[model samples]
Target chain A: MIIQVQDLVKRYGDFVAVDHLSFDVAPGEIFGLLGPNGAGKTTTIRVIMDILAPDEGEVTVLGQPPGRAKGQVGYLPEERGLYRNLKVLDTLVYLAELKGTPRGEARERGTALLERIRLEEWADRKVKDLSQGMQQRLQLVAAVIHDPEVLFLDEPFQGLDPVNVERVKSLIAEWHQAGKTIVLSSHRMNLVEVLCDRVLLINRGRSVLYGPLAQIKQAHAPHSIRVHAADLPLDLPGVIQVQPDDGAFNLTLVEGVDPKGVLRELLDRDVDLRAFEVAPVPLEDIFLAVVQDEDESEEGVNGLA
Target chain B: MDWRKVWVVARHEYLHSVRRPGFIIMTAIVPLFGILVLFVGTFFAGQASRLGDFFVEQFDSTSQRIGVVDRSGYFTPILPEYRERFLLYEGESEAETALLAEEVTTVLVIGEDYLETGRVVAVTKGSGFGSAAVSDSGSVRGFFVDHLLAGQVDPALQRRAANPMSVEPRVVSSRGESQGEGAWGFVFTFVVPYVLSIFLVMTIFISSGYLLQSVAEEKESRVVEIVVSSVRPIELMSGKVIGLGAVGLTQVMVWMLSAVGFSSGAVALLAVVGAASIPARVLILGVVYYLLGYTLYAILMAGVGALGATSQESQQLAGIFSMFAAVPYMISGFLFANPNALLARILSFFPLTAPTMMMLRLPLAEVPWIDVAGSIILLLLSIPVALWAGGKLFRVGLLIYGKRPTLKEIWLILREG
Candidate 1:
């Protein structure tokens, strides 16, 4: 594992920002840290980067205590900011130098990275002179200027448009192909679904779901199928519920029943089936389901008390 | 501690701050203002002397002559110089008539009992208080001395009687070292150190203010997280303190050098401060105290600044320490009267007040070597402790946004550290 967090607990006074959170990121893979706003994603990343101390539990990076591998780890915080008075290239160089890169090499890499982001012309301009999108790109360059082996990017796509988001995604892909570990924290489920291999979904400082993205989706995959057929029977064998879905009828099977059985039964009833396919739940629906489940449970506990 | 990272941060901070428009303007303003004051002072001094000469020339004009009525019987002859401005009249009524006609600016009447009582009166142009003629009274007295002693004594003896004596005072220290002549030397002895101490305090505050502002900016702008991810909080704080200290030093050096370069008063000031009461040790001590004082305050302020949610709030939070720095100045009268007083000794040992208090005291009195060493040691020792506490506060505070920490929370943070 490139990054390992175990039983991590952090609090800000009365507020528990990260409560008994445990997860690990394998080396050379993209791991999504999925959470809603105020869901302890930023705080957890801060702890892993050694930017904040955990009130309890332990975090290790590169098989060492947090912060021991300083130059090897990179972080782009959720709240993006840079020295507005500094030139674009200079800011990147300074940040790189702080991570132990010498000035000459840092500047060279900074220049190259600026070119990669198409900000080479703005290299000599002050950061304040750059527009918001330009600054965000420059900030991303700053994160990777030192070429660290492991990176933690919090909400890296928050302020980006689709085109820029695709640009950043491609950049991440290039790094991933180069065998770097990435812990990407974002509330953007669509991006996470497209990019993440493994994920840790957290809600209110506690883990909601954790594992390989495929396994979690497989485990939470509803036993349902969508059928685009005429005169579909509302009460089909082994089907518990049916609902209209985007010009198709979604049929929910019994808990132990397979969608193949329902499909065969549909064919046996001689339904004019135009289309039939298993419906895979989107990560967004799963995220909403898990979060709402946690909220309803907490409310029940509160009412009992 | 990574010295390399610290150096990088320090260098970046120094360059960034020094290039700021605010910093450049502030740095230039001090020396520029000093030069302006020097030129204006010299111009006014020259104009004042020229105005004095003009007034004398005007008073000596024929239209503004003095009428002297000699009623005393002993008067045989008036001197040649006295004849230039004074016209002897036979009676007071005649002199009074010349005064009313504006032919004379003043009229002097000698009483008949001059030998016994030496009574004389002056009559001038107006009947109100401004009519009394006292501006050129010294010349009139000189005239009296020249005439009175004319044939009574030898010329040299008469000259001696007229001018009296000239006193040249030289101070000798307890060690029998000579502090060069006159009251100006003694005045410089107190004034120079007092002024330098004020400069030291101002520089420390200004520099520490830069540190505060720098920390506040990083926090407010949300850049600190990225920076701190590469460097330790202590390293960041140390770098900023060292860097901004240099900035303050640069500012003070420019002002001091400009003072020495641009004005004759500063040259005379150095001469008196150096040749008279102040020894060279004061300058060395001044630099040492400034470094220690700046580090101590800068670290404390870095913590306080990080705790604030905004730069303006940080400045407001810093006001308490600012007032504390002024304590020595507030009680400066006692310091001047008794540099080795108990209160002065107490302030000298305190880290916050020590720099200014000791600067004021060093030139004024023979401060014991133990106190000097102790104060410096105390100041030097307080810095690391401040760095520890401040670094902790700064570490957590940088990540805290939107809300300023409460007193209890700050205390908790300190305790946690």
Candidate 2:
């Protein structure tokens, strides 16, 4: 593992921002730090980046303490900012130099990054003068300019336009392929679901669920069947609940019922069915279910108090 | 520590700040401002001297219903010019009555033995009173000289009898050498010291103000986090101070060098005002004090900026330190003349007022090297402790938004860190 966080806890006065949280990122894997607003994802990223210190437990980046691996780690904070008064290229070069790259090499890499983003003409232009998409591209260049071994990106796609979002997604994919360990945190669950190898989901400073995305999906997989039936009441003996969805009825299956057996029962009813499909639960459903459960449980506790 | 990074940050700051329009205007004007002020002052002085003459010319009168109390008849043969302006009377009572009755606006009393004693007292009714030395032929003194000594005495003696002698003093040294006693002694002893003291304090305070502003701007704009994550807090703080110090040094050098190189009038003015004796050692010390003082204040300002939620609030908090910088300058009037006064000496040892207080005293008296060195060493030594505590505050507060740390909290943070 390139990064390991064990039982990390951080508190500010009466508020605990991160509570006994533990997670790890293997070398060259894209790990998604998943959470709602104020769920301690940014705080955890900050601790691991060494911008902040964890009050309890251990955090190691690149097999060393957070601060010792300074030059090897990069961070893109949730609230992004650059020197608006500085030229785009100058800002990048300065950031690169601060991360231990020499000025000459930094300039060259900065120029290359600018060209790749088609902002080479804006190299001499001030950051404030750039369009939002252009500035975000430059921000990305600044973050990864030094080729840090591990990159912590918080909401990296927040302000990006659709086309540029695709562009940024490709850049992140390319960087990941180049053997860089990346920790991405964003509200775009589908994107995270598509791109991340593993994820750690937290709520109210405590972990709700964490594991490889495939395994988490498998563990929470619900047995739901989608059927396109003509002239049908859409009720089957094995069905627990039925809801209409996009010209079809999606049925929740009862426990211990075989899908094959349900299909046989549907055929016996002589319903004219055009399509039958068993769909794995999407990540969006899982996120909502987990977060709603947390909210309801907290409300219950609040009522008790 | 990490001098390369320090240099990099310093170089960037210097390059950026020096290019600002405000810095440019200041750099271009500072040296010449002193000379410009001198020219302006000289012009005003000249105008004031001519003010009396101009008014006298404006009030020149042809009609005279005047009373002259000439008991010795010194004006028995008064010149026609004088007669037009005066009506002489032989008795003091008559002259007094005419004066009181408003028959004349003034009365001139010429005493007994007027030929031997050239004293004349003119009393006026509150108009044209201080133009006593306007000794033209139309003047009262010229009238007395022309009337009393027409071809009876030599012209030079008559001229001497009319006006006070003008003297230019020069002090002769024990080596039999003499020099013109200009106000240069006062200049070197008081004015120069005051300038240096204020200079030391202002440079430190103002340059550090710029540091405070830039740091606060970075923090507010959210660039500090990215920068801090890459570089250590100490490194960033050190770099900023070093960078801004270079900006200050560049400006001061430009002002000083331009004064020496371009403005000969400024040097002449200072020389004429008795500032020629200012020792080079004092100036060199000014430079040293600038570096140390700037470091001290810059670190403190950074600490304040870290703890403040915004630049304006940080500057408001930093204002108290600026007041500390001004303390010695504020007390300079009381302590400058008496360099070894107990209060002055006590203030000189204090780290807060030491640099400026030393600047004021170092030139006026024969200060021992130990005191000078001790004061500088003391200021230098205080910097590390300041940086240490300030670094703690910076680390703890840089990422915090919308909250300012209190003094007790800062102290506790210091203790823990």
Candidate 3:
């Protein structure tokens, strides 16, 4: 584990922000911490970055405590900030230097990053003059200029246009390919599903789910399937549910039955099947299901479930 | 605290401050206004002096109109010189118009038992009454009074009473260099230090508040977080304080140089405007006191700024420190009258008021070396404490969001550390 957070707990007075959270981010993997707003995502990231101390926990980044390894880690805080009056390149270089890069190398890396972001033309422009999307891109460049062993980004995709979003996603992917550990926090489940190999779902400051993304989805086993046919009767064996609309039928198989077997049975019945696909459960559905499960469990404890 | 990182933050702050048009205007305009006021005042003063000399050279005869309401039979007797300057009138109404129309400069009204009871009255527009314009309506009134008084008094008695006793004073210093003196030296020594001290206090207070406001701007903009993440809070605060102090020092230097140049030019223009010697020790003390004073105030301002969650709050916080900075100037008014008083001594020993009060007393040579040393020691001791407290407050307050901290909360934070 390149970054390890063991039962991390942080509280403000009587309000707990992170409760007994444990996770490990392997080297060279893009890990995501998915949660809704005020779900301890930023707090977790701040803990890992050593910007805030956990009340009772151990956080080791790059084989050292967070404070000792600050320079070895790069962090892009949720609250995006840059010196508005400073030139783009200067701001990038300053951030690079802050991470222990030499001035000459910082400038070189800053210019290269600016070029990569397609903002070289704005090298001398004040950050306040840049469009919001462009400024977000600049902030990303600042974060990654030093190329730390681990990167912690919170809401890095905020304020980004689609094109720039793709640019950043690809950049994160590239960083992962280069064997750098990444822990990304976002409310956008779709983006996380596309980029993250593993995820930790947190709700109300407690982990509701944590595992490989694929395994988690497989375990959730949502009740929706895709079916395509020229004609279909209302009754069908093992077809416990069906909703026909938008020129497609969504079916749910009965207990202990394969969706593919149902499709095969439909074909054998001489039905003209155009397409048969077992619709994969989206991460969003899994997130909602897990969060709702936790809420229900709490309601059960309160005798209101 | 890494000095290099601090230097980076300092360099950035310095460049940003110097680049600001407001900062540039403040740096230049303050000294420029000082020089402009000095020039305008000196010009009017020169004009007034030249007019005085011209009046003294051109005017030879002096007179006044007096209204007398004597109801006694005794005739008045006076010296020829005194009689020549008085013009008695019969009624107050005629005297008022004559005085208004520049016909007479004065009117003397003497009522009942004029000589036996020695009752007499005189009124005049004082000196330089009608010098701007000359009229001949009351020109011979004093000459007629002199002839009438001569007919009433003995000629021998008038000459004896005309002249009276007069005395001249002398002074002796330790160096046995007794120099003739005038009110000019007293005014120069008393007023210049008081004025300069006020100027210094105002300059230091205003410049330090500018520093605080600048820090608040960066904090409000979230730039301080980025800077402090690399450099320690103490380094950042020190850099800002030092940078602004340098800017202030630059302004003071400019003002001093301009003052020197202006004075030399003024001396050449008017030979009678003597060169006032400023003691070497006073000059040295001024610089030392300015640095100490600025540092003391700057650190306090930085501490106040740390608790300020927004620019507006920071501005209001700075106002409180500005009042403290103005205390010394406020007390200097009383110092002028009693430079060596117990109050002045106590205030001069206090680090906050020491700079301005001691500076005020420097020209008078009233501040002892021990008092100066004590003030310097106290100020020096307080600076590090202030800086440390400010750094602590800044470190904790920088990341605190939402509400600005109250006094109790700030005290709690300080005690926690």
Candidate 4:
């Protein structure tokens, strides 16, 4: 593990921003921190960035304390900023120098980064003159100009149009492939599912789910099969209830039933089954289910009161 | 403690300020105005003194004629010079005719009881709409005393009888030199102190304002979030303070160097830099006080800037501190009257007021070395505490936005920080 956060807790006055939260990132893995708007994802990121101190517990990043090894960590804050009056290249070079890059090399690297982003023509232009997407691109370049070993991106693709979003996605993917340990926080679950090897989902400062992406998906998989038939017969062996999935019916089985045996029995009974499939549940469905469960539980308690 | 980061931040700030069009224009204009005021003011002052000397020389050599209508027989024998200028008239009409024909400059009419009353009136020009009282006829009185009294009284007593006694003026310097009194003392005593104090105040005010705006801009933009991730808060604040201080110092130096150039040029062409001359001690002290004063205000402004979410908020917050900064200048004039006044002495040692107060009093009075040393020590000692407080505010407030922090909340932040 390149980073370990053990029993980490952070608070904002009376509000618990990150409550006894503990998670780790394996070396060279793309880790996703998933949460809703006011969830503790951002608070956790800030603590890991060393921008905020945790109220309790410890975080060891890159084999040292967060700030002790900050030179090796690149962080893109949720709220973006750049020297608006400065040239794009100068802004990048200056930021790189702050991370301990030499001035001459920083400029050269900044130029190359701008070129890679197709912002070379706009390098000499002031940041305020650039489009918002272009400015964000420049900001990202500034973040990784020194080629840090670890990266933290907080909603890095926010405010970006689809095209710019793809551009930034490719850049992040490229960075991930280059053996840089990366932690990404965003509201876009689909993107996280595609990009992250592991994910930790937290809500109201408490962890709702955390594990390898494949394992989490497996754990959330419903024991059901989709049946497309002309007449779906009820009272089938091992069938408990049926939910709709497009034109097909999702047949839920009793806890320990064998779906293959049921399909074999159905085939023998001369049922007109056109198609039968078992698919892994979508991550989005899992996210909505867990969130809805949490809200309903709270509502139930409120109803009791 | 990271000097390289501080240096980088400072260099960035310096370049940022120096490249502005307003800074360049202001740099060019300060000394031009300073020099023009100095030379032109001295020239007019010099002209007034020369004009006074010219009037005295003309008064001594100019010729004048007088016609006297002495009804009472007081003067039997008249001197030759008096016969030419002070001739007796037969009647009032003749005297009036002689005066109107440009024959005499004045006509003196003796009163009916002139011998007993010693009363006389002289007429010449009209009584214009000015402060020319009829009783103010010094020339007529002088003629009576110098001419008429010379014959009436004994010669030895006559000279002494006209002017009984006069004061003999004397001025002694601290070096025991018998220096005569003149307005020259004002040039060093008042002008130097006034200019140096004002210069320190204006430079710090403008420079610290720039520092405040810069920090607030970074905060509002949320750029500091990324910056603080890499560098410590004090390092960033110190870099900005040191950087902007350099920019202000550069501007003031340009003004001073240009003033020196203008003074040298004036000495060559008009010979009038004397009235505007400032002592070497004042220059050195001005620079020292300016540095001290800027540090105090810069960190304070930096704290305000960090707390502010917008440029206007930062300026308004700094405005509160700036109100106190003006108190010293407003009360410094009193120190001119009594340099040892309790209020003046108290303000001299107070950090907020020390720089300007000392500059105001140092040139005017023989300020004790202990007082000067005390004020400097107090100012220097207050700086670290201010930085510590400002740094605390800066670190805690850098990330906060939209909402303004109350004093209690800020104090809480200080405690927590």
Candidate 5:
């Protein structure tokens, strides 16, 4: 594991920010932490970055605690903080040096990153003078200029225009391709769905779902099949119900019935089926369902535990 | 704690300050203003002294012209004995005409029964110069008349009134140098202390204000978080204090040099006027007091600055500290009268007031060696405590968002840290 957090807890006076949360991110994976605002996502990231210490449990990054591994990691906090008075290149190089990069190399790497982000024109401009999207891009460069082994980004894509969003997404992908461990946190599920391979969904400081994104979606699969046919039957065997809309039918299968078997039966009935798909539930739907479930479960526990 | 990191922070701070138009203007303009004010003050002072010297010289050169209309014949012989010091006119009309035309300065009229009444009245025509000049002329005439009266007293009465015993003053110093007696010590004790205190307090006020405003600006802009992540809070605070303190010191050094240059010119002017020179020890004590005074106020100002959330807030907070600094000023009248009194001694050892009080007393030669040593020790000890508290407050205050912290909140923050 590149980062391991065990039962991490953080309290501000009597308010608990992170409550007994545990998770791990494997090397070379983009792990998404999906949550709403004030859902402890930022607190967890801060704990992992060593910016804040947890009141309970342990956080180990790359086989050591966060501080020991700080230089080997890069963190882009949820708060969009940058030295507005500093020139873009200088700010980037400063952050790189802080991560233990030598000055010469940090400058060289910072320049390269600026070029990659198409922000070389703004190299001499103060960060304050740049547009919000441009500043966000510069922040990304600051995070990655040191070539950190692990990158922790909180809401990295927040406030980005679509073009810049795509640019940032590709950058993350490129970093992951270079075998860097990434922990991505965002409230937007679509971005997380496209970028993340594994996810940890936390609701009110506790993990509601933790696994590979594909597995989580499959586990929460709805009992529905997509059918495309020139003429569709009103009803079929092992099909409990059907809804025809938008040139296709959403067929609900019976309990314990195989969707593949239903598709085969539909094909044998001489139906001109243009397509057959087992309408896998979207990760967003699963996330909402799981979070809702956790809320209900908490209400029960709040009455007792 | 890393020197390299501290240097990095310092370099960044220096660059940031040097690049700002405000800093550049202050760096250049402050010294210029100081020089300008000093020149203006010196010009006015020189003009006033020249006028005074001219009046004294005029009085010494010319004797009073008196027209005595004494019908009693008692003053007939009295005028000739001191005739060289008096110009006698025959009639009041003649004297009045001479006085208006700026010839005779006085006219004395004695009644026919003046010997029995012993009554006299003096009058002079106005030169239209104003009442003050006329009053001054009257005073000068009074001096001459009093001397004349004393000279005319009975010989036996004068003999009896003369001092019965006299002792010749002697000095037995090995150096045989004459000890100067004048208000110079008072100048050293009162004026020097007051001026030095103002400079010290102003330096702290200006520099700490700059530091606090810089911090608050960055915090409000959310830039402090970025800087803090790279450099420790101690490094940031120390760098700012040192950088702006350097600026303050530069202003002070320039002002001091200008003052020294002006004083040297004044000394040359004084030589021409035959006035005593300003002592070298006075200048040395001024410099010593300035340094000591600055150190005491600068550290405390830095602490007060850290608790402020904005430039305006820092300024308001600095006002309170400045009031504390002004305590010595408020009580300086008492200090002057009793330089070595109990209150002065206690204030001299108190770190906050010591720099100003000691500087004030040093010129008087009233500050004991032990008190000076003790004050220095106390001042040095307080510096670290101030820095530590300032650093802690700065660390917490920089990260705080939204509402400004109260003193209680600040205490809580320090405790948390």
Candidate 6:
């Protein structure tokens, strides 16, 4: 495991911020830490990053303590900021140096990263002079200035416009291709779904779901198929209902019915079908469903108590 | 502690603070302003001296005369040199007549019992208050003293009797060497330390403020988390303390040098730094206390900074902690009056007030070596404790946002740490 967290618990006074949380990330894989606001995701990351100590249990990065492994770990904290008084390039170089990068190499890489972000012209300008999106890009550059082996980016796309978000997404993709382990934490399910290989969904400081992204989507996938067809029959065998969905028809199949059989029925009816596919649940929908389930279960436990 | 990282952070903080417009302006403007005041002062002083010399030339003693009526038989024959200014007469009526005619500025009557009672009366035209009265009285007294010892003593002996004594003090060392600095030496002994104490306190105030401001700025900007991820809280705090202390020392050195430079060029005030020598021990001790004192306050202000969520809040919190440093200054009068007083000694031993207290007391009197050693030892001991406590506060407080911690929470944080 590149990163390991076992039975981790952290608290602030009487409030438990993380409770018995456990997960691990493999090298060269994108791991998603998905949760709502105040769900202990930040606290968990802080403990993993060794910014905050865990009240109970253990965390090890690269078979060592977090502090020892910090040099190899790059972190972009959820609360994004840089030295506003420092120049853009200088801030990146300083952060890189803090991670034990040599000044000459840090400066060289920092300049290259600035150029990569198309921020070369703004390198000499103070960070405060940059627009919010530009500063966000610069912060991203700072996070990876040392080109660490493992990167933890918390809400990396926050405060970024779509173009910049795409820019950041491509950078993350490039890092993953270079075989760097990454723990991408965000509540934006679509981005996480597109980028993460495995996920750990948390709510109220407890894991609500954990597994491979494809397996989770498969398990949560609805019993339906999306078909783009005109003149589709509502009263077809093994078809319980039909509903219009995004310029297509959603066929809710009966229990134990194969989706392929529904497509066969549509073809026999001579329906002009433009497209057909099994409707996998959107990660956003799965996220909401799991969160709602957790809340209701919690209420049930509270009611019983 | 990661010495290299500490060094890096210190270098960064030092450069950052010195580069700030606020620090630059404070360091530059104060000395420039001091020079301006000195030049302007020298100009006015020159003009006043010239005016004074003109007045002296116009009103020299040749323009005034005094009428004396001698009943004591002491003025049987007026001395030839006194014949110009002193006009002798037989009775008080003749002297009064000369005075009414303005032949003399005053009339003096030496009584018949002058040999027994030593009484003399002077009459002058009444003007509410004037320098004329002072000059007339001086002339009459000189006439009486000069004649009182005419044949009984030598002229030099009479002159010595009239002038009395001029005191020149020499401080003797244990090795039997004596150094006399006269009045300027005394002024320097008292004034130098007083000024040094003020400077030490100001440096502490300014440097500790920078530490607090630096911490508060990092926290307020939400940049502390990223920085702390790569280094410990203690390292960050130590770096800021060292860096800002250097900046404060730089500022004070500039001011001191500018003071010497400006004072040297002036006419009337030039003796201040030139004639008064600061003891080597005081200079060394001043630096020692400044470093220790700055560290103590820097840790304190850093803790205060950690507790505050905003720079304004940190400043408010600092206002309370600053009262501790201000205690020495507030009671400076008592300290000056009695340098080795019990209160002064007690304050000197306290880490918060020690630097300023010692600065105030060191020059006023010979502070015992034991007390100096004891206070320094106490200050040395206090820093680690402060760092521990400050680190606890800093570790937890730097992460909290949008609200100040309550006393109970602070206690809990310390306890937990």
lDDT of each: 0.82, 0.77, 0.71, 0.79, 0.69, 0.81
Alpha-carbon TM-score of each model against the true structure: 0.82, 0.78, 0.78, 0.80, 0.75, 0.82
Off by over 4 Å in 2: A161-164, A231-249, A254-272, A277-284, A291-305, B31-197, B259-277, B335-340, B363-374, B406-412, B415-417
Per DockQ, the best of the predicted structures is 1
Query: For candidate 1, lDDT tens digit of each residue in B1-417?
Result: 888888888888788778878778867875776677556645564453243345555654334577888878544367886687778888889889988897777887778899899887878776634234443455666667778889889999877776566445565655877755454444335555556567767889888998999999998999998988888898998899888888888877775565445434533433333335444566578778888888888988998999999999998998887877788888888777888999989999998888878877877778989899999999888988888888888887888899998999989999976
* Higher-scoring candidate on TM-score, 1 or 2: 1
lDDT per residue for candidate 4 within A1-305, as digits (tens), equals: 78999999988889888888889999999999887788888888888888888889999998898788878999999987988999999998889888888999999999999999999999889999999888888888788998899899999778888998889889989998899988999877776678889999888888888999998887777778888887777878888997766888989988767678779977988889899877767677888899889989999999999
Candidate 5, residues A1-305, lDDT tens digits: the string is 89899999998778888899999899999999998788899888867776566799999989998766657888776766687788998888767766567889988988898889888998999988999888888888787888989888888888889999888888999999999989999888777777889999887788888999988876778878888887887668899888887998888887768788987887788889899998767677887888787778889999897
Model 2, residue A165: displacement in angstroms? Answer: 3.3
* Residue B358 miss distance in model 3 (angstroms): 4.4
Tell me model 2's lDDT, rounded to 2 decimals: 0.77
Q: List the residue pairs that clash in candidate 1.
A: none
Q: DockQ for every model, please.
A: 0.80, 0.62, 0.35, 0.64, 0.34, 0.62
Residue-wise C-alpha lDDT for candidate 2, range B1-417, written one tens digit per residue = 577777778888888888889888867775666667667645665353343355456655434455678867757766665676778887777787787788886777888866687666666555655324232324565566666776789878877776546433333333554322434334433455456556555667767888998888888878888898888788888899999998888877776565443224534543343224444566688788888878888988888888888898888998888787677667767765677787877777778778777877766665667778888889989999888877888777788777787778778778886
| Residue A232 lDDT (model 3) | 78
Please list all clashing residue pairs in model 6, or write none if there are none.
Answer: none
Model 3, range A5-68, lDDT digits (tens) per residue? Answer: 9999998767999999999999888899998899999888877766666899899887888766
Q: What would the per-residue lDDT of candidate 6 be over residues A1-305, giving only the tens digit for each residue?
A: 99999999988878998999999999999999988788899899888788898999899999998788778889999986788889998898888888889999999999999999899999899999999888888888787888888999998877778898889999999999989999999988787689999999988788888989999987787888888876587788998899997788888877778788887877888899999999667787998987888779989999999
Q: How many backbone clashes does candidate 3 have?
A: 10
Using DockQ as the measure, name the better of candidate 5 and candidate 6.
Answer: 6
